[model samples]
Target chain A: MKAKKSGGNSLFSVTAILLILLVWQIVCSAGLVSPYLLPSPVDVVKAFISDLPLLIQNARITLIEAFVGLGLGIVIGFVFAMMMDRFEPLYKAFYPLIVLTQTIPTVAIAPLLVLWFGYEMTPKVLLIILATFFPIAVSMLDGFRSADRDTIRLLESMGASGWQIFRHVKFPGALPQFFASLRISVSYAIVTAVVAEWLGGFGGLGVYMTRVRKSFSFDKMFAVIFLISALSLLLMKLVEVIQKACMPWTKTQ
Target chain B: MADLSIRDVSFSYGETQILKDVSLHLKDQELVSLLGESGGGKTTLFHVIAGVLRPDRGQVLLNGQDITGESGHVSYMLQKDLLLPYRTIIDNVCLPLLLAGMKKKEARAKAAPNFADFGLAGTELQYPHQLSGGMRQRAALLRTYMFSLSREGSPVAALLDEPFSALDTLTRQEMHRWYLGMMEKIRLSTLFITHDIDEAILLSDRICLLTGRPGTISEEIVIERPKSKRDGFAVTEEFLEYKKRILKGLKRT
Candidate 1:
């Protein structure tokens, strides 16, 4: 049942993408903007194919940074959330600061991180972790708090210890929210990885885009933009797939 | 197997007294119902008995042990099934045993034998969402039973707070019949809380009446029908008499 609905959704998404690309191509062909400034789909495709090897190399670096950052972010976020949940005083102290972290523009902090951690993967990964962990942590904390009160009571009556309550109830209860945040964080990881690279990086898609932009290679710039969007979409899809596999019960009703 | 006694328990939330001098006891192999109006502290009493809440006065005793302000002595089932959404039926049922320090494989094996008795034989691998409401309740009850049974390697009392309240009328009726059979088979000293007088009459051996602003047990109506003769007893004259007496008791409050 769910398969059919998702299939129809994909078809609609494909049609929408095609419609958007067709309109973009028409605008480019109509000379509404200079070809140098607004490359056609064909020009972007050609650029992509010609620069495939370099793009692949750069993409590999960015993906590594993103995945590492995503893993670290999830761990850190979960630990922070668990601490806040387990201790009321910690929750009172840390919750406001957690919210505050998101208020400072990530872009504004990118340069500082680059300066602190140098032009290496460390800064990029750290930036990705910062960008992605907030939503994951906050959502997880909410899920933990909103766990059915009765179930906790039930477990308590069973003589379950604190750890048992966490394992048997709180963690599993928080899973749906964790997965929900993961979708956002997966995209966030990639975006932050690239943004961090934009500040300073030896090699990555962001660096390649920077290099291409400096040379006035508009078609290649379009290629990189398309590549970044495609990567983000792919990562989001991967998270969805993992979510379905891990939470098969959700598909049933 | 052990008896449960709630002795002169009084509880208040801040200035609002919920229960005043509430006392009740569960005989071994008996099913007792605490019938009360909504917001009349039935759940609060259950929480106190289940060790989720501490009574402002008095104590809860399991067998001869004073278990006040301590949890994991009685198994509890709430209005909602409260099944873990991500777990399969078997895994959900295995939770109590798992929490009791049984190995995973051993716990799974232990829980496997009771699936047929619970009328959940074919759904061992299915998730909670895949089951009907009645089926989920059965699973929850079975989990509750397992939780109580394994807590100290003996049969323990269960506190059920409107376990069948979420079902449709027909399903609820059907569940009551199934529950009576299951109760007999498991034979855990049970305290069921319900506002439904008919349900109380249909399932419980004795019905304790709780009512009014400061909820207390105003009366206890004992059903004299033996377990073997209880089939279709809900429509019998004796059942109606018991129901009438309960209505009068509730009215007095």
Candidate 2:
């Protein structure tokens, strides 16, 4: 029953999207909107097909930067969360700082990162890490802190060591939240990489979008925008797949 | 077999005293229930006995050894089953053994045989969410039993804090039956915490009434019946008498 309900919802979502596309195509065909400003769905599709090879090449670069940055972000975030959870003093001192990092806009940070690390892949990766790590760290820390006190006491009663308590209880308890944050961080990683690339980069989807915008080829720019959305959605889906694998018990529920 | 004793234990959370001069004992293979109202420090006493909290005064002893302010001497079970969502039933039950430094393969081998005894034979490969409420409680009980196993293979005492309180009435009654049967077979000394008068009378060899602002054992009542004879005991005149006495004692407090 639940699965069927979700399936119906997805069908409605697809239909809604298609209806909007049809209206867009009609408006562009009637010359009500300039193609340069608002390309029709058909024109965007055509542009996507024509620029497929170049898009793939640039996407590969962006994906590499995103993946590398996201991986590093996860490691750093895990460490930060562990430290915060294990030590009260550290948690008190660093929790606000961690939250502060999220207040700064990614766009604002991208330029500074580019200036510091130059137009190379370094700046793009750094920007992605900066954007990605906050959610992972914060969510994981919350997860750890939210572990049931009774359960912790239960383990402690069994002569479990500090490390044992962490391994058997805290780590597993944090996984669901970790995956939740990873979904957010994954999209942040890709978007941040692209944003960083826009400022300066040898090659990436962002750099390509910048070039297309300068040439006034809005159709190509629309295609890149759609592609980025698709990529972010794909990464989020991958996170869900991994979450299922890691937490099979959730599936049974 | 092992016995547990909490002697003159007093605990406070800063200025707020939770327990005052709380002392209790569980003989080998005996079941003792701590009966009280909410905020009566039943849980605080359990925490002290479990060694998760240090008493401002007095000692917690297991088998005549002082275990005050120390953990890992007794097995503790909480209201929630607290099965790790990411692990299989076998793995979850084997947690204590793993924490004790046993190899994973060896721990699994040891725990596998007892799954049948615990009425969890086929659930070895399943996760906690796949089980019913009653089944999950049984698994948690089995895990608690596993935690109580000494290096030499003797079972220690267990501290259970409202282990079946969350279940529905039917399941709770069923759990009561199952618990009595398991206790007969294993002969584990247990200190159970609960506010339910009928449950205290049904399961305990002795019931300790904990009451007042700074909680202390206000009274102790002994039930005169063999374990096997206690089936359907809730409807008996003797059960009613005990319940009336307990209710009067609680009301007095």
Candidate 3:
């Protein structure tokens, strides 16, 4: 029954998307919008099919950067969360600073990163990490804090060590929130990599995008945008799959 | 196998005293209930007994040895089942063994046999969310029991705080019967807390009335009826007499 309901919802979503595409195509065909600025859906598709090879090549580079950075971000986030949970003073001292880091615009920091590390993959990966880690760390910390007090007390009564308590309770308890943050961080990772590449880079989807925009190949630009969105959606879907595998209890209900 | 005594334990969170001069005892293989209303510090006393929280005064003794502010001496079960959502039922029950540094395969082997005794044999591979409320509680009880098992072939005492209050009326009654049977077989010493007078009368060998602003043991009533005769005893005149006495004790406080 649940599957059927979700299937119906997805059908509606697909219909709505198709309707918007039809309207866009009509507008472009009637010359209501300049093709140079807003290419029709058909034009974008043509551009996509023609430049598929190039797009795939650039996408691979961006994906590599995104994956590497996101993996590191998750590790860093998990460590930070564990430390904050274990030490009261560290939680009090660094929680505000962690929040503050999120407020600094990734765009503003991207240039500095590029300047420091040059136009290499390091700056791009760093930017992605900076963009990705906050959500993972904050959400995981919240998950850890929200663990049932009674449950912790129970473990303590059993004479569980601090590490045992964390391994059995806090880490497992934080999983749902960790996955939630991972979904957000996954998209942030891809987008941040692209943004970083725009400033200066030899390869990647963002670099490709800049080149296309400069040449006024708007259709190609639109195609790349669609590709980026598709990639983000795919990554989010992967996260969901992994989440289901990790938390089978959630599926029983 | 275990004897637990809380001696004149007083606890306060700053100026707000939660417990004052609280003393209770559970003889080996005995079941004692701390009966009280909400905000009467039943839980506060449990925390002190569990050694998660230090009492401002007095000590917690197990087997005549001081264990005040020391954890892992007893098994503590809270109202919520608190089974880890990410783990299977067997794994959840094996947590204490794992925390005690038992090997994973050995822990599984140890916990496997007890599943059938707890009415959870087929549920070993299932997740917590897949089980009924009663089953989850049973699993939690089994987990608590595992925690109480000592290397000397003697089990430690268990501290249960309203362990079945979350279930529906029918399920709670079923659990009560099952719990009584299990207690007889296991011979575990227990310090249980409950607000329900009938529950205390039905399950406990003795009931300690904890009441007042800063909770104290107002009365200790021993149920003289044999364990075998307690089936359907809740509706008996003897049960009513005990209930009336407890109610009067609460009122006096």
DockQ of each: 0.77, 0.69, 0.70
Query: Model 1: residues >4 Å from true position, as ranges?
Result: A1-16, A19-33, B211-213
Grade the docking of candidate 1.
medium
Ranked candidates, highest DockQ first: 1, 3, 2
Q: CA lDDT of B147 in candidate 3?
A: 82
Best by TM-score: 1
Colliding pairs, model 3: A158-B72, A159-B72
* Model 3: CA > 4 A from native: A31-38, B13-22, B150-154, B211-215
Give the Cα-based TM-score of candidate 3 against the true structure.
0.91
Q: Count the backbone clashes (under 3 Å) in each candidate.
A: 2, 1, 2
Score candidate 1 by TM-score against the native.
0.92
Worst 10 residues of 1 chain A by lDDT: A149-158
DockQ of 3: 0.70
Model 2, runs deviating above 4 Å: A34-38, B12-23, B36-38, B150-155, B209-222, B232-253
How would you encode candidate 2's per-residue C-alpha lDDT over A1-253 as one tens digit per residue?
9999999999999999999999999999999998779999999999999999999999999999999999999999999999999999999999899889889988997888888889999988887788888888999999989988867877777778889888888898999899999999989898888888899989999999999999999999999999999999999999999999887778877
